[model samples]
Target chain A: EADIYQTPRYLVIGTGKKITLECSQTMGHDKMYWYQQDPGMELHLIHYSYGVNSTEKGDLSSESTVSRIRTEHFPLTLESARPSHTSQYLCASSASTGGTEAFFGQGTRLTVV
Target chain B: QQPVQSPQAVILREGEDAVINCSSSKALYSVHWYRQKHGEAPVFLMILLKGGEQKGHDKISASFNEKKQQSSLYLTASQLSYSGTYFCGTASYGNNRLAFGKGNQVVVIP
Candidate 1:
């Protein structure tokens, strides 16, 4: 089984506060992804990384940013929280950036009030 | 672009079969399937590459129609454990970015 993990299973914060969601994987996969999902909705990719020292914005145009200083760690940060940013943030890893199956972390549910 | 998933929701009993479809407008080279239960992250089920390839994981199988830029997931002998939301992800030619469909919520009863 894939050994991906996300910290802070749930978070509720005040508006304008800065928050960071942590993601880590033990499988040493080369590709990592971050997605934001709302209830009963499809997941929206906010950011993804090809490998260490590489990060790219996704199609959703999220206000959050990500960093990939290490291959096993990818974290998403929101500078200023808003109600709109309240959603489930998921992290995943795959062998490659293209055609491989991705293993997901448990996910972090953030609620910005 | 995001793919489109048909039958947004489905209900079935154990041992029944169901099909979930994913269609994309762009030329697809890969299709991925995932299942997520309530309050959990999605788990990858399988991946289907171009050239009309079919893959199976236990009783869960899927097919990719490269020519039509579509894919279908087949759940055979559905178990209550299969109850969850199914999502289909697609990657078009020359693109590494993955996009997902609206998702199909499936409920398998005893």
Candidate 2:
């Protein structure tokens, strides 16, 4: 079945370290998004891509950046990690932004020391 | 802006019923619902579009109120499998982006 996948279900990194969270979808969706959530907190949109070569910052200001070089892959990178960056990062994809249900990946839990 | 969900948390016994509401200040084109177990990704439950369409899986139904820019998920005869955090996502103006509510935690004890 078509699905979204995120690598490194859990990650532990030290401060100032660089890390990349990989998200890939087999559904061939044009719209992709990344969300951050802390325990018992609401999900916050951090980054999104409309299509390949198109990326935008989301409602929440995040230190991470994402690239959409291919339709199936949307990866988020943190140039420098911090304790505050520790949270669950969720990846989602939809056929279109106009109308459709999003499919989410298992998610990556990052622990920045 | 994020949508508001009522009843931050609720506990229910098996076979009981409950309703979770999601409201948005902005006009909505569609509303989506999902359930997430602890440490798991949120799974799509249903979606309600404009024009008063209602949809969901077996026993789990939902309704949308276009006028109120809100939606409600109704759980009838709850089951242990239904115990999880429920979230409502609203998208407006055909925007691909969805604003999700904080989520409602539901626990069904047998």
Which candidate leads in TM-score?
Answer: 2
lDDT per residue as tens, model 2, A22-111: 999999899999999997678888888889999988889998999999999999999999999999999999997636889999999999
lDDT of 2: 0.90
Per residue, candidate 1 scores C-alpha lDDT tens digits across B1-110 of: 89999989999999999998999999987899999998877888998886589999989999998988899999999999999999998888776678888899999999
Instruction: Report lDDT (Cα) of residue B84, candidate 1.
Output: 95
Return the clash pairs for model 1, or none: none
Q: What is the TM-score of each candidate against the true structure?
A: 0.94, 0.96
CAPRI accuracy category, model 1: medium
* Residue pair clashes in candidate 2: A97-B96
**Model 2 TM-score relative to the real fold:** 0.96
Name the lDDT of candidate 1.
0.90
What are the RMSDs of all candidates, in order?
Answer: 1.4, 1.2
